[model samples]
Target chain A: MIEVRNLCKHYGARKAVDDISFTVNDGEIVGFLGPNGAGKTTTIRILTCYHPATSGSARVAGFDVLSQSIQVRRHVGYLPETVPLYPEMRVREFLRFRGKLRGLARGERETCIARVTERCWLGEVVDRPISQLSKGYRQRVGLADALLHNPRVLILDEPTVGLDPTQIRETRSLIRELTRDHTVILSSHILPEVEATCGRIVIINRGRVVASGTPQELRSRRGDGAVHAEVRAPVEEALQAVRELANGAKVTADAADGWTRLRVEATGDLREPIYRLSTQRGWTLRELRRDAGSLEDFFVRIVAEAQMQAPQ
Target chain B: MRATVAIMQRELLSMFCTPIGYVVIAGFLLILGVLVILTEGFEPGQPATLRNAFGLMPFILAFVVPAIAMRALSEEYRSGTIEGMMTAPISDAQLVLGKFLGSAAFYAVMLGTSLVYPILMQVYGSPDWGAVLSTYIGLLLIGLFFLSVSIFTSSFSSNQIIAWITASVVLASFAVGGFLLVRHVGGFWRQLIQRANVMGRFEESALGLFTTGSVVCFGALAGLFLFLTIKVVESRRWR
Candidate 1:
């Protein structure tokens, strides 16, 4: 489990991570969603003990990030944004070196190396130098390096920032599989990537959290229910009836080839009301449905809203 | 300590894994050989001593030691591997000490190869084993001093060339640069300059002199730089 409270990191006079607070429970796969320069990387670095916060506190795996940083580091596996790696060393060599640095004994190092190699699909390229591997393979090697010690928390910064679609799919599946053993906290700007992979999402803008919830919850909370209806009644009557039910919802109606099409947009689910109204009016009901707004739109809107509230 | 050794091995691994390590050793040995031969260290008529060889170190080490130590931390910074290294369970002291020891060990090997000269001299001339041992010990101590300064400078920038230049300029101030001011000044200032002079200490110790004061002085300076490097590294976490 990871708990962060009022975490602030400043570089000179600029606030990189400005008083952000959140938590990730055990067996949870959380996505840190943010735009560029939104302090995603800075927060990750602080959590990994790469840098200390200017004020506030963070604890990882029951150890404080500042006072118990060594213990925190021991339990944390970090894959940085750029996938920092030694280019000359072979995959196995690099893993062994990292395992040794992580204080793994000889036998444990080899076994850990083998386990990660197998888990991360690094078996075929274990003998090749890191420079020779493709970008996807290099990313896997970085992930393998992080997994060498079986850390309690796996913190990945933009785990799939640069990859082909197929590789992205593969990596997403691998991350999902890893959620069984590790409390995974990954940061990404890609909306669908997080929507598809993570169980919970924390969206940040201007170094502060704009919103946090599951993908379904964020969509439902931000995007009120809008119903689309097709009725054989007159366009004016259909519009008035839906407008009366919607009570200030943006209702529109138009007649197209003998059918009145009505749209009712409001803060709550209006589909059932529209269906009952269409059936009671003795009109032939044709179509009634609602489209859930994509997380992309919600992400853009909240981030823009946050920006307007606190102008930089 | 185990982490320190692990880092030291990685340091050595990076150095020897490239051709630069071999090239440097060969070049330093060849240059030292030519310089010793050009002087009369092996001449039958001259005294059988290694004073001339040890005398050349401050000048050569002012260039070569930094060349060897320049990339230790600088490359890690430039390549972004420092993020990985700093986040590991090891302390900053282990990281700094490991890199310093690795470069010093490489210097030991480079300096060890030059022992061929005394062996050749032993074929006919009775080279003073006391001066030989003291000279080697003195050079290694100075090498530690040089490696610490160079590694400290390596932490100053991500550019290896900049690190090399910074280390060279700082070391030159003690080895050669300080002498220019020492001649013009008198009394305490000159005494202070002479007291910390690397070339002067090596020259004195090259004549079979191994005083506790000399060891303490060089050892303290090396320790100071190592401590400073650790501080600079630790400061990164704050920034």
Candidate 2:
């Protein structure tokens, strides 16, 4: 439902968003992963029509961001990094106002308000002043505002920031629920949050798209293909035997009092061979757990590699 | 139009909900009353006239209107609410005009309370009704100018204090340059400054002379500032 092509945004000499391009299909949740100042928010702003792209084109729900911004705005619901709420306004009133501003008819507005109030779990705080709400509720209020118009696409920038762990989980589930009918583009620095919530991930660094794919796809790109195993064997003998067994494989070994810890890199799963080796060597296998690198590991390795290669 | 009215109503509601609105109106009234009593030389049985009441309006407006409008967009910017607003379906013009009208409406409320001064005049003496009406017209016109200037100042930064000071400084120029003391400079420079004076634009309306030139002058000045405000707001999105 969204298409961005070679978008560039510059502030004088510094480019905040480089020539980036991406697309979001209907009912898919996409995560924008980047550290601070990585142009995540800048990209979101361009898609929302809050700011103009320096060059190239962005279309939301089939409307051009520059030529048809109003129509684009109508089709997309946006939750900025900070929830823009008037402190004095109560929740219900604020949502109602937002609905009307989106040009919802009277009855339609009321129905949408009620629907979002329930969907975002805002019913309890419906009458509370925004200033009195907890961070979690404030985040929900932001979500509710975006959903009130019932737009086909939702763009949320850091939807889970500053919330407690439980609140973050709740927000994640809420976002996941939204995927049934709406396309979601969420930007966040927390890798696990994105991994748990998004079907696809787009990693950005220094105003450019570094990588974009499914979590599993990005993880495979790390090329480590390494599996970590904790084998409780005679410290010296097990390390020597495992090193010999995995011929030509790079194995890093760490020996403690009783057990040897080893990381073995192979083209594919070596769990069966490693187990057979341990048995043949007559070593006590106390803890032999296979490790699959997660999205966090994948993200850190990529970003750190990029940073090292970057010019000062 | 519906969007404009929605924003205007929200702004008006926000103003009335807080003590800032009350403080502004009460402060203006207290200062106006005290100034009339001290400068106009009150008499026990004589009717009150807006002559002294409106005489000090230009000076009061220099600060009052900016104070009222200082937080309109500046606070939204500071608090990051502007991001929310910009993401909304409302156009840039709607946002700018809404804030301008919201502040202007507050200024109008401040001016409306001063009507008590004229009513007090009727109770004491037969003040010229025509001059009183013209003076109010003058006050309203001045209000429009200050509103636009303050809204434009609000666009400069997210800092409300900075916005207030900047707007005050810009608005104060009209008061200072228009003052007779400044205009009375014994040189050609005085004549030039006097011709450019904003307070001079208020002269016809205050004196009960319904001059088209003065009316046009205030209207154009207000329009100019409002246009500037819209431009600044639009430019900020790019930056």
Candidate 3:
């Protein structure tokens, strides 16, 4: 539902987003992963038509962000990082105001307000002013406002920032539920939050997209395929045997209490071959394990690599 | 148009919900009342003309109107609610018009309460009804001009106090500067200042001379400031 091509945004000499391109398909929840100052908010702002991109183009729901910004805004519901809200307005009143601004009919506006208030768990404080609500409730109200018009796409920037653990879980599940009918692009620096909710992740760093794929695909593609083993044998002998068995393998060994801990980096799983070697050598195997790389590791490695490649 | 009305409705509702609206209305009426009853010396048998009341309007609005209008957009910016308004489907012109209408409605209310003077004049003495009507029409025009200037200043800053001060200075240049500086200059300069003077046009209307030139002049000034406000709002996307 959203496509960006070679987007570059420059604020004077500082580039906030540079030559970044990514797409979010319909009915998919894509997590936008990036650290602080990773151009996440800048990209979101451009897509939502709050600001114009300096170069390149973006389209949301088949409408160009620059030319048809009003249409893009109509189709995309945005919840900014700071959750812009009128403090003096009651929850229901604020949602109704947003509903009217989105051009909802009178009957539809009432029903939508009621539905969003229920879905966002804001029924209890529907009549209270927003300033009187807690941060979690305010965030929920922001979510409710975004969903008021039932737009096709939702772009949320750091949706779970201020919520407590329970609120965060509820928000995650709520977002997961939204993916059934709406396309969602959620941006956050928290790794596990994205991992738990998003089917695909796009990691951005220093104004560029470094990696984009499913969490499992990213983990397997950039993962360190290694076997770690601790054998009750001479450190040098075991290291030499493992090295001879797997050619071109990088082996690192450490000796502690008469046991050699070997980390072998090679293609494919080497646990079976290492097991046979321990049996053939008559050496007791204390620990043998294959490493499954995690999304965190992939994120860190990609961001570090991007930073290294960035012009200094 | 519906979007503009919706925004105006919300702005008006929010304004009245706070204590500022009541304070502004009461404060304006109190000051106008004191000026008419005490300083201007009104007796029971005095003539029912509201010359003193309408005479001070341009000067009074120079300060009071900004106080009413300073919070229009500045508060929205400070509280971060401008994001919500801007991200809505409404265009910048619609937002500016909506806010202007809301602030105009508020100034109308503030101006409405002062009509008691005219009604009282009609009861106690024979006042020129034409002059009374024209004076009110003039007040509304000047109020629109002052409110537009205040809204323009409010758009430039997020600080309400700074918005108020900036608008006050700008309006003072038109209201007070014309009279104070006209005496020091002669020939074309005096006429130029007099032409730009808000009080000069207002005095023409208060004297029951309803000229199209004065009407168009006030309309043009308000339109100019509102246009500037729209430009400032649109410039935010780039800057």
Predicted candidate 3 versus true structure: per-residue lDDT over B81-146, tens digit per residue: 888887889899999999999989989888999988877776777788999899999999999999
Once superposed on the true structure, which residue ranges of model 2 sit more than 4 Å away at CA?
A: A225-247, A251-263, A274-285, B44-48, B179-197
Query: By DockQ, who's the top model here?
Result: 3
**Share of native interface contacts present in candidate 3:** 0.69
Report the Cα lDDT for residue A20, model 3.
93
Relative to the real complex, the DockQ score for model 1 comes to: 0.69
How do the candidates rank by DockQ, highest first?
Answer: 3, 1, 2
What interface RMSD does every candidate have? 1.0, 1.0, 0.9
- RMSD for each model, in Å, please? 2.5, 3.0, 2.5
Over the stretch A131-235, how does candidate 1's per-residue lDDT look in tens digits? Answer: 899999999999999999999899999988778899899999999999999999999999999999999999988889889999989988876556788989988
With a 3 Å backbone cut-off (N, CA, C), the pairs that clash in candidate 1 are: none
Better of 1 and 2 by lDDT: 1
- The DockQ values of the predictions, listed in order, are 0.69, 0.68, 0.75
* Candidate 2 clashing pairs, residues 3+ apart or interchain: B46-B124, B47-B124, B47-B125, B48-B121
Provide the lowest-lDDT 10-residue window in model 2 chain A.
Answer: A284-293
How would you encode candidate 3's per-residue C-alpha lDDT over A1-312 as one tens digit per residue?
Answer: 899999999999999999999888899999999999999999999999989999999999999999998999899889999999988899888888898889998999999999999999988999999989999999999999998898899999999999999999999999999999799999999999999999999999999988889988888897477889999999889989999987878999999999999998875789999999999999999899988767788888888888888878
**Residue lDDT tens for model 2, A83-146:** 8999988999888778778888889889998899998889889999998999889989999999
Estimate, for each residue in B61-97, the C-alpha lDDT of model 1 and write its tens digit. Answer: 8888999999999999999999999888888888998
